[model samples]
Target chain A: MSHPSPRRTRDPARKQAAILAAARAVFAERGYENATIREIARRAGVTHGLVVLHFSTKEQLFVAATTPDPESLFKGVLDDDVTKLPERIAASFVHRMEASDGADPVIALIRSAAGDQQAAKALLQTLQQTAVDGYARVLDIPDLATRVNMMGAHLIGVAFSRYVLADGPVAAMSPDELIARLTTTIRTILFD
Target chain B: MSHPSPRRTRDPARKQAAILAAARAVFAERGYENATIREIARRAGVTHGLVVLHFSTKEQLFVAATTPDPESLFKGVLDDDVTKLPERIAASFVHRMEASDGADPVIALIRSAAGDQQAAKALLQTLQQTAVDGYARVLDIPDLATRVNMMGAHLIGVAFSRYVLADGPVAAMSPDELIARLTTTIRTILFD
Candidate 1:
């Protein structure tokens, strides 16, 4: 029998990356409960068994898709000077939403969580503990958890209304205007 | 022909009010699409046919249930002095949420809208025009529409996170504290 081609045994790392990218897109579009492993595998150009082998379960795949690298999401905002943190964080969130063509993964996660109790719990934990709690410590303000939570809720609300709901006036505002408006609000919550 | 009893000929207005109340509860619990006409009728102690006679269709019933008297929702917030508008609005929203035991009609509307495109469009129109735009006109500030929309989004986010998702820190925050923090954020958005 002829030996299998080397191309057929391509890099495992590249294959895994492709699967993850496909999972994010699929989950973002159809949500966690509605998105199936088969569809994700098809989108990734891999077999269903391969997806199962990698992610093990739909929940695991969902967690992978929605919980992107926290560093990537927060980036320089976390390490910046304390006083200017609000502006930097606001700018970073707005820039991230713009870069993604206004379909932030966090919004998708929130939307998906609306229908499922377990999903909602997962989202709350991810956001409250992993995201907001960490930022609260870095800021080192009294009652910072409440402040961080409120700020996050406001930012998420803006994203949902402006991007997902596509409210006319909100969607019409320029990026500079949005960043400025958001920075003001964030400053009030974080510093004031 | 024998005359019918006066009790059998119940007051149409009273019956209509009962039906609407039941519709609100059912729709709030089960959402617009998931709630059935029969269940609403059962809750109202009326026949399904009577519900149809009053509301015409499921869509109409949903509209009636969610679109409570605007004055009831906003109360005195719209007419308050511009300087105290933020605190008044924030207090009113938080108070309404507490009054409803966290199952506010607006939150129900938002949850229903998450799964249906038509429902989402209807909600956006109701919120943007009937609520935010009206508040914007009252405020008379430049870009007040954006401000009102952002405020609405933030309040909605807080309600969802605190009441719907029941986030620990958000849920634990007292109404006074919640209103206070929200007032500061609203002030930043509206005035700063």
Candidate 2:
């Protein structure tokens, strides 16, 4: 086989990050339906073969791009005691949004996955497996399953509508205002 | 040209709705990126020329498909006083989800619209404009623009995540449960 390209062979870590970043941009711009491995490779300044060799598939690349880094969206909270449930849960949700830097590319990914079943199976499960569990640990309700799910739905729906749809004044509000209002709602539901 | 299609020449209302339904399905399935008038016509069981005769263009057909007819999402609310705010707002959101019956095609439309300027502008603005005006009128807040926009973002975000993503248990909850939990949260911010 031909030797790996010299530029790529020199810096594997940088190449990996470049591929991930490129995947995010292309996925955001084109949505999963239209985004292609070739486009991502082109955006990353890498060859088609490199993408396949690195990520192995477009689905895998997208999963890597969006599957929220569990540590990033919910790291410290998991270790905290149960009594701090409401604040921790609220902080976790807020952290995810803040970590995203308001770009909310994950929203684009979830929306794309909505149109594609396999993609949906991957992207839509993050909350069920991650967020719900995090909240469950804190709430410790016997019916934790239902309550966490409800609150999760509300938070997810509200965030998507306000930020992604840019519906009315929500999209225009300062992030601080949003945090205040949403944190109140979230705190009430989780703590009360 | 050949004789006009019977639906076009004799039954404008039937033909118009048929085209709109077809457009909605096409936008929902193929999304804006790949949707074409030709495909919409084929789905509608009409000739391409017939689609043009009614909608003039796919963009027009798309707007016509999502455009609120009786008013916008908020028309009914604006007609009444502020007391009906909670139920009306909840109903507005629930109605859209119920009408779509959980298979939200609008998600695909919003996702595909990220790159299409005209489609994005029309769809996003319609979502924001009507709800802002309606929701703002009901609440006590004097600065409607900032508060409404922020709340709108939360609404769309939560709805998309819940309804479109079908985020497992979250989406499975009954409308009554959702309204119970979310309505209180909404009231806290809007009424208080």
Candidate 3:
């Protein structure tokens, strides 16, 4: 005489989200090498077998953890050409990155991909396409691909070194300083 | 002839150099994650036990491996005033890096220390001392400690993302482009 259980149907979605969250956390803490399927399952409060049953392996889980926001990352930057090209591109990159000050989950995914060639290629291709396509569509310039790529490198590289690596001088900079200085530098690179 | 055989003592130095070279190559190719003592020994054309006898452990070997020209790293950069700081720092840093590009053999040693917290600390401390001691002696700057640390983070983070992680756009830029853009961007941060 029991009512139908709400937990049974909703459990899958909840479990999936939990698993993904666990994957990101574990990957960040352990990087790619030390992260294990059992640890992820434990973090998610699921059984080890359940993780295997769902994703098959650590690599699969790593890939899945990154699946949700692919299109959004592209769309966020691409469609945000609300200002003209150089300013929008430079500002948006720093702004969005600065937004992730306390919560840069994408960094772990990106950094871990470096250890695996195939994963790196996938991430790299998507990044290049989104940046190149967005810049080309939004602006009229010579060497669109090269200039965009170079400017993009300095922006992200500077940020990564300063914020993520907490590399000294850069980490000391306030976010406003970061955005202003970075934008000014990259603005010239992109336009002038 | 009863020879004064300096060659008698020379072989050990030769062996040490060979081991260092092998360790560097192995560390760079596999990074900290995949590198192993066995593989390094194989590369050195020495037995595993020989490596142990010489180095005691991988950790000791790593410390020994980080010996580069620390004195030269900031020598040229701090020679001038604040206005010239950015480009000077960039040139000297990149010059040191570029000069050692192929001849630099301690990469595996550095990579090995990346994740292990104690090891990361040791490596970081060495670099920090190098930057501060050198920069403070040469430059007319205040807040040398903070600047040294931040610069370390910036350089390390940038190097990891650009070279080791090969993060898309960061990976694509040439050395000249990297130095140029990084130099300009680091200007505001490096100066008042």
Candidate 4:
């Protein structure tokens, strides 16, 4: 086979990045049932076939585009100092959610899940597998699962109120205030 | 003018009740945007004009169907015993949420809000006007607004996790257990 040029190799990667970005926008805007592959491909400036080639199905594409790598996400927050975990976790969550470059995937999942029971189940599964389980392993505490569940529930609530609902005092809070408040509440859930 | 028959007076009340019930079912099943006035009328076995005559608009009908009388709701929970407020509030919320007769109106609001920003705003406004403000006035604590926001956020999160997402340890929790757990959390938020 002829040697591939550098441009040829770079084209696939560039095309994929474009497609993923477009997918996130479409999914966030229209949710699951309303979102279409044609729209995503058109927005990405790629052929629909290329999108299908890269990700065989819409579900696969949605999962790939919306899911932050769990390993990296957990590693960043799951530091050795148990005393500081609450602050680190709360700050990290607030920062990721407030990131302006891309839509927050968890919020997108929640919006979509609101109308779709299947999506809601998938979101819960994703959170359990990624957040709750990760926390359980890291935190040395009794009833770890229940504690993690409460912690996850509170964070999810703050997210729904602050990001999804986007109103009320919770939504009006400055990021630092939100982080500080959440850290205190999270610590209570974990330790108190 | 001739006195109207008793049946004529009762007909309007009965028709209004039917329409409200049907509206609730349709809104819960199809969400806010997807629900149709015609469908609600059909389910109620009435003409579309009747639904409009009673409520004037789908928005009004939605508010009628999903909103419990806030006065009655608050009266039940906002008792004089400040020490028991956490338990009373938590238990009241869990009971109303677990009511099997009609759909939980708050959950309906939340689900509908997920797909619609305007609906989300309305939810926040309703909660702020009803739950947060009511709690603030009764709790008699410093920074009551912020504390109520935190309490509301945690409760909303629990609702989403248990009622909406419907999985995990939170979902599996018995009503008594949930109420107990929530009372502790709410008390901490309110007092500690």
Candidate 5:
């Protein structure tokens, strides 16, 4: 077996990071259906082989690029004081919107899932494992699962209006307004 | 100009209705991207010319087929007693889900809007003209527009979870359960 050359081995981690960032941009711009791996590879300035090596398929790449670190997000939300949990959750969502500069993975996943079965599965799985299960695990209340799911539904709608549709009053609100509007309702969904 | 024969004189209204129904099914099954006018014509048993004659473009047909009569829906929702208005609104949503037999036009619109700009515009316009404006016109409250928009956002999210995602606890709820869960929250968003 031939050993890899120094050029091939040099800064693999940096190359992987570059590919992920490129994938996110391409997915956001072209959407899931129109987004291509070759385009992603070209944008990343990496060979097609390298992109394939890092991400076996476009679906996997799409998921990886669009999905937030659900674990970290939920953990941070839950780790806060219970009285402040809703505020923290709202803040985290705003932080995600700001961090992504409006290319939110959850919104992307929802948009792609609108037409693609695989994306739909990824969306359901992500929400279930992240928001629904994450909240249910910590909060003990009657009809917790249903309430959490409803909360997820509400947030998904808000995201759709503000980000996807990008019109109407919900879309017009500032980030501070968004957080203010959502915090009370989110609290109501979880606790009341 | 040549006079049309009796064979060409079939009920125009009936034919238009058939085409719209076929368009809805095709759009629902194939979504906006993959759904074809040709297939819709075939399903409707009309010539492609007839389909085009009725709806000039796929986008037009998509808008027509997927958009509920916002005027009627909101009029009906608003005409009721103010005390039971929330329950009526919730019931109307459930009634829509039931009437469509699971191929919900609003959900289809939301799903398509996720990836398509025109659909996004349609979703926004429909919500703004129908729900936001309708509610704001009827209810005199502080921040009425923002409150109504938030209410729209919440309903859109609930519809997404229950219909599009189809796997969460919200999805598993019965129609009555859905109405019961949604009524209180919607009331809160509008009134509180």
Candidate 6:
């Protein structure tokens, strides 16, 4: 029997990704409480049922949308070489955030979390478990959790000011300058 | 001439102060766009007409509310003694923020500005002219604006995480630890 054409088959992975991309956009614009499944589906050019099938609920979709793929985002930044890890991580983070065409998912997550206690708790737990814990494990330093936490606060603060808030001097700075300047502060946190 | 009973006489300054205080609380709670004059008037225990007479419009009220009293907040942090400026600033900021029983006007301004371009622009301008310029004047460094900007980002980031987002480790950090750790990072940004 002749197999159906590959193009004719619906790729679940591709469909899910489309839904997530739309969800991210919607969530970023409207925040979690205001974003609706129908709106996300409309943005994705998919049926509402398809989105529901993939994400099950708005909270599920939100969690999926806001959650960063830490491995991909931090590629090699958390590796064996603890030296320059701060610089590398800061560079990678700023690069990723600046590369985004619209609101960064982290900013969206933060904005959404600000209005919702439950979402905020989940977001913090996810960050602690994923990024913070990963950094601690890779670095294997004493009081690594606190270090990672401080590092995150610094990075997020810069990101919030530069990207989210669009502060004048911050937004005016070139990416290289930001990475370089931020690296110095990050280094102190990680090393000092 | 004997002044009429202070309680009966319309003390414009006292009335204005009450209205501004109420505006700050309302703005902090609902943000600028969402906050209403009627609500602010109600909170201030005055008539809506009185609020309008005092501030003219919600926009004006917001500007008034979010504006920090620089002298109270900055104090000696912006003085000629630049050696401990970072530590002093960090300490004063954290102390003021922690001491507040309700939403911080700075945090409220930030959250409120996130969605409003005009508000964001005004906020940035205020910071540049106030905190940044103050630091530049005191520090006398060529790149003092950038340095102060970085310091702001770091302090805001820590404040945002610890107070706004209530990140676990950041919030769990004792005031002394938070101040000490943040002072170190701020020192790097300011002097290093």
- Highest lDDT scorer: 4
> Each model's RMSD to truth, in Å?
4.5, 5.0, 5.6, 4.4, 4.8, 3.8
Candidate numbers, best lDDT first, in rank order: 4, 5, 6, 1, 2, 3
Q: Report the number of the highest-DockQ candidate.
A: 4
Per-candidate Cα lDDT values, in order, are: 0.73, 0.63, 0.59, 0.77, 0.75, 0.73
lDDT of 3 by residue, A92-189 (tens): 65566676542334355334532454554454445556667766766677767666655644554455444444545555667765666555555655
Q: Candidate 3: misplaced stretches above 4 Å?
A: A1-10, A47-57, A67-103, A109-114, A124-192, B1-10, B72-85, B91-114
In terms of lDDT, model 6 sits at: 0.73
Q: iRMS value of model 3? A: 4.6
> Tens digits of per-residue lDDT for model 5 on A1-192?
266533344578877877888888887766677788999888877899989988898889887777667677675788636788889889888777667655667666656755666865675567656776677666777888787778878887887777776787788888998898788888878787
Question: Which candidate number maximizes TM-score?
Answer: 6
lDDT of 2 at A126: 60
Predicted structure 2, TM vs. truth: 0.78
Q: What digit string (tens of lDDT, one per residue) describes model 1 on residues A31-147?
A: 555678898888777889988998898877777667757768777887647888878888998888888753456666556644665665676668666666558657766777777
Please list all clashing residue pairs in model 4, or write none if there are none. none
> Which run of 10 residues does model 4 chain B get worst, by summed lDDT?
B1-10
Model 3 Cα lDDT, one tens digit per residue, B1-192: 455333232367766776777776665676655767798777777778977889997766655665556655556666646667777777766666666653342233234432553443455556677767877765556766765564554565455545555555556667777778667656644553
**Model 6, A117-168: lDDT tens per residue?**
4665576567666876678667767888888878877877777677776766
Question: Where in model 5 is the C-alpha error above 4 Å?
Answer: A1-9, A71-76, A132-138, B1-9, B71-76
Query: Backbone clashes in each candidate structure, one number apiece?
Result: 0, 24, 10, 0, 0, 0
On TM-score, the stronger of 3 and 4 is: 4
For model 2, give the RMSD to the true fold. Answer: 5.0
* Candidate 4 docking quality: incorrect, acceptable, medium or high: medium
In candidate 2, how many Å is residue A6 off?
A: 11
What ordering of candidates by DockQ runs from best to worst? 4, 5, 6, 1, 2, 3
**Which of the two candidates, 2 or 5, achieves a greater DockQ against the reference?**
5
Residue A68 in model 5: shift from native, Å? 2.2
